[model samples]
Target: MSALANAPFYVTTSGGYLLVLAIILPAVAVLAMLLVPPRHVARIAFAVMAAGLAVALVIVAELVGTGMALAYVVGGWQPPLGLALRADGLSAAMLAMTAVVICATGLFARFHQCLEPETQDGRAATTFWPLLMAIWSALNAIFVGEDLFTLYVALELLTFAAVPLVCLDGRAETIAAALRYLMFALLGSLLYLLGAALLYGVFGALDIHSLSRLDGGAPAVTVALGLMIAGLLAKAALFPLHLWLPPAHAGAPAAASAVLSALVIKAPVFLILRLVLDVAPSSAGPLAGQIFIGQILIGQILAVLGASSILFCSVMAFRQQRLKLMIAYSTVAQIGYLFIVFPLAAGTETLPAWGTIAWTGGALQLVSHALAKAAMFMAAGAVAEAFGHDRISDLGGFGRILPISALAFGLAGLSLMGLPPSGGFIAKCLLLTAAVTGGHPWLAATILAGGLLAGGYVFRIVDRALATPAVELVARRPIPRRLEAVALVLALAAVGVGFVPLQPFGFLQLGRPAVSAMVAP
Candidate 1:
């Protein structure tokens, strides 16, 4: 029975079609948007968003019910010769989370677009809907792509879809920012492609599962891993490579900002995680232990970079005079916490990284931050729309004018600050526990310091929201209550993630190689 179960199956499952549907639905919507009359575009986009959300939710339900990763062997051909689309626990979670954020962002954008009827067929409005769908499709592809080559294609698709959103307003500065983003992204892509080529040449397979079974400690393999990881870090905007993120995110429209901050950057980070955890080899022999040690060393190096990002970017966030720029900087800072999980999740000789508490913490942080940051961006957008400018100093008592938006911003800030009864708090606490237990005191210190710095920046916004301005500020136009509600709902979801059991998440471990199974005889 064990052998039978282990045998390769070239057939598709009942749920396999869902994966195809998830990727193609948005692409179809993009095509429809181009063909349909301009006036009907928003309606079609919303319809697609609703359908996409349902598909994502169904995928999650199917995974939870079956307790297995969903895989579709395209055209009944398996790896090495054909592409496969697979979603493990992490991918499914990210899929659902991405769908939720994209749906909310679409709703927000719809209202904003409607506010200016003249711009319905304008470049920003018509272009945004299709691009949004394109982004959704590319993100889905990245999550499900089982082959390195397929992922490279998905990354390119994502970049093309996202770069234009940055300059949707078509301003000179924004266009310049978009160009900077494109150039850096292309450079990262080239590096990643080179690394992929190296791996393919060495292993004769581009599939992750196949690569995982190979002897992974070869110098060539190490070099390829280094190149791939560095390229992904640049795309993820981690620390020193984060130069393109702030301007691109801040200058984009609010909906675009939410999508970029909440989703786009995560693709490369997800790839990094996959490369480190799935493709790397671990076994019981002395040589295997050395391989494990090398991987751990890499994890430690990443943790240090994560710490620096938290410290440096948090200070930058606190210093920003504009609300959107401050939030953009905060994104870079919050992303650090995700990387800090490297050392914590780098389990000892007796354990697997997937089984570590830090793994769950990291996943939770990713999902919670996506929700919270999306909410925060939308709220900040609302504030900017009402007041005409996002200058923090000039927007005193603006919360009184936009009470719901203020509430949304505060709720999102709760997660960012890692306050109690919030998902960010739970995630940080788990990571902190792992750090202390692992005897990594510096990592523990970094966690606390990051939280403190987050508090400072969050307080800056909250203080301005409540304070009375010396010169009263008037809203140029009133923000719709429903728009503020969308942000608040997302923020509440971020807080709600705290309620999950604090133990190592069993769901995230599902479909991953078992620690016991991997043990050598």
Candidate 2:
């Protein structure tokens, strides 16, 4: 690694202000929404989305142009005392993915609301704009925040914003689901905060850059990381801690479900990645013996949990009769792939974890899942909107009625099922290859089994779409082509990811050398 990669301090780059714009633009729009008339809220939201997307693109461009992480020290103050925002290649990918999904979701929600013009300026419609923008702001903040405490605050904002979205329809069941989500999420927040406090007390700093430079053998460090990972697992809805997800995701309106499933849960997962890779001590120096054992233990435990989630929730998804609930369960199943990366990407003395093929596979899975799952939810929403319900058995001949939605659903399923010409296939292949080469046959088996299970669940819906019912299915209301088109575009994007080379992507590795240098030395 170069000297620049070994630098522990952050330097404010020329384009660092773009990160601030990314976080604040949606927030400013959120405040603007509160002062505007109900009729103008959506307009403001649309404008913000456009600008936010542009900012995210610019951030990505600057990152590629400079070939370094963009960093901005707040108020010209350094970390361990003040705050900083940084965006690497991974962060830029996340920002761009978020912008695309949020934009697609906004269009979907706007069209869905237009189905009932009387409700266009109604409470639910108006309330959605501010909450959506708030989520955008929180997600952006989480992506760039350089400290653990800042991430915790961003998580709180995300939780508070996301909970209400679950109950936006104001149904008793939806409200109950929202409350369940809130309770579990709050418990997660408490655990995460406790861990952050412990870290700060031990090292006198909470910034990732500062902590990555410290020794990792202290008992407090281990316990703090354990607590934080456990807390993040709950928030991520990884299996066993995942009881709140299905109902909360399935019960929410389609746009809300898309955002929650595709974007919100990912924040905690991102933090976990940082914790394991950047903050965890490398297995070197005098304490190498102790730290190596600890790292392996954590990786194995998480891999087992991930395998269990993939097998168990996939089975549950196959059994669900409701369209949204099945997709919701699939979300949990898909999340397993990310956790399994911990073990698959375990570093050697010479190569860092992020340099492995498994790391690229995991990143691909995250981005592809975000795009594919959002399209699936939007397609399901369109189905429910066209018909009065989403019961798969009764949805026979649906393809004949809403061909666009049916096509979108099927295309998204291609990714979930790990089929060819889709991002999911390439991701799973990389992961499977890593598992085999890394001498983890069981994980390789689990990867194959998970793909099979995913196919079973996906084909159920596809079969229904191709079925000939005794009574022909009919649309309860006409769905706009534009609404369906948004989902198709997202699904296509998911598919487009397959075109990338099947290797550790250079783009994803752009800003990782610094962290790798710190962790592996």
How well does candidate 1 match the true structure in TM-score terms?
Answer: 0.97
Candidate 2, residues 324-426, lDDT tens digits: the string is 9999999999999999999999987667787799999999999999999999999999999999899988999888888888899998999988898899989
Candidate 1 per-residue lDDT over residues 482-511, each given as its tens digit: 888889999999998987755328777766
Give the Cα lDDT of each candidate: 0.88, 0.91
Candidate 1 C-alpha error for residue 292, in Å: 2.1
Error of 1 at 27 (Å): 0.9
- Residue 412, candidate 2: Cα error in Å is 0.6
Give the count of colliding residue pairs in each prediction: 0, 0
Worst 10 residues of 2 by lDDT: 1-10
Off by over 4 Å in 2: 1-8, 282-285, 502-504, 514-521
